[model samples]
Target: MSNLIRLIIGFALVGAAVALFIFGHWGWGLLAVFFSICLFVTYFYNENMLIAQWYLRKDNMDKAAVFLGRITNYETQLNRMQHGYFNLLIGLIESRTAPMKSEKYFKAALNLGLHMDHNIALAKLSLAGIAMAKRNKREAQMYLADAKKADKNKLLADQIKQMKDQLGMLDRQTQVRYSHR
Candidate 1:
């Protein structure tokens, strides 16, 4: 459902709740208020994305992908803030099968902007990994630096350290090739 429709439904429920209260149906008014809150929550969080995230937490990409795929047109279905997240989820799922292809999605996610610092760090880290895979050491280094900066809570500290180690290995590999030449 579109975010606008959900907002309208939420307002309608609020009206119903007000009506019930005025009619002395306190219990039904409370129920209507609860349902309205749920609708408002979905307006921001997006039901399909929430389900997909749940599956992702379980490391079930296939199921997660299915739920993500349900949002045929995310621009209409999701809130403005959720645009980045939707792309981020797609990128993560695609990375498992096609790491290179996922790069665009990651870029889109970054461009659209995410709400959380950790998610921003995750996207940058993923981009750094992609750059490393492509043997673009300079690009990888930049992304790693950005990822480190974005990871304000140290949530990706271990992964950032590991990536830096791998980048050092890249440096060694190049040195070895130069020595052989």
Candidate 2:
């Protein structure tokens, strides 16, 4: 359906360009050609990003990672693409046999200073998870607090709060166990 719509629109634009050229409207024809090219590039670029996002959402991290890896040189202007790459990396760490290696990518993203809310939140969340895994409660809490501050999404905030509570409970349990021992 989408392909058909695209084909119809492409033909229509080409027809308009041809009509303008036949009418001796060189400027209009050139403008139409430029517009068509712009539209074509924009469509594919957007489509690739959407595909990557879809794969990520479906938890098909390998496919998402492949698609996202195909996108290079366009990251400077495509914050979402960069975010998607980082997301794929995080997913791979979560589901793959390899140990989680996302800290470097997350730190690089943070260093990019993109200020994208989602990216910042994800980076912080990743760091928080790492901290919690290492039993660094203070650092974990700090990262979770920072993530909560960076995003106003209630879901993310709630998740951070939950993580904090879990960490607190774990800490208390560890202390109780150690003291009893």
Candidate 3:
């Protein structure tokens, strides 16, 4: 549903609740108010994306992708603030099956901009990993630095450390390859 339509429905429900209150229909008024709040909630949290994130947490990428697929045109279905999150979820689900293909989604998510610093960090970390796989050490290091900066709460401290360690291994492999000459 479009954000405008959701807003309209929320307003309509609130209007109905007011009319019910005026008529002393207390129970119906309360119910209408509850539904109105739910409609408003969709502005910040799209149901499809929320369910997809839940499936992701459960380690069920198939189910997560299915839910994300429901949003045919995310621009129309999700609010501006939610656009970044929608892309982030898609990137996460795709990363499980198609690691390289997920790079674009992660890039889009970063471009769209997530509100949470931790989410930004996760996307950067994923990008760093992708770059490392492609043997782009400089790009990977840059992304790792950005990811470290964005991870303000230390939520991704372990992952960041691990990535650095992997970079060290890459150095060792390079040294061995050069020493063979």
Q: Best by lDDT, which number?
A: 1
Colliding residue pairs in candidate 1: none
Q: Model 2: which residue pairs collide?
A: none
Which ranges in model 2 have alpha carbons more than 4 Å from their true place? 1-48, 72-99
The lDDT per prediction is 0.96, 0.68, 0.93
Give one digit per residue, the lDDT tens place, for model 3 in 1-181: 7778899999999999999999999999999999999999876799888889999999998998899999999887887888888988988888888989999999999999899999999999999999999999999999999999999999999999999999999989999999999
Q: Can you tell me which runs of candidate 3 are displaced by over 4 Å?
A: 19-27
Return the TM-score for candidate 2, rounded to 2 decimals.
0.64
Model 2 lDDT per residue over 61-86, tens place? 77876766665644553545455545
Q: What is the lDDT of residue 102 in candidate 2?
A: 65
Candidate number with the higher TM-score (1 or 2): 1
TM-scores for all predictions: 0.92, 0.64, 0.90
Ranking by TM-score: 1, 3, 2
The numbered model that scores best in TM-score is 1
Q: If both were scored by lDDT, which would come out higher, candidate 1 or candidate 3?
A: 1
TM-score of 1: 0.92
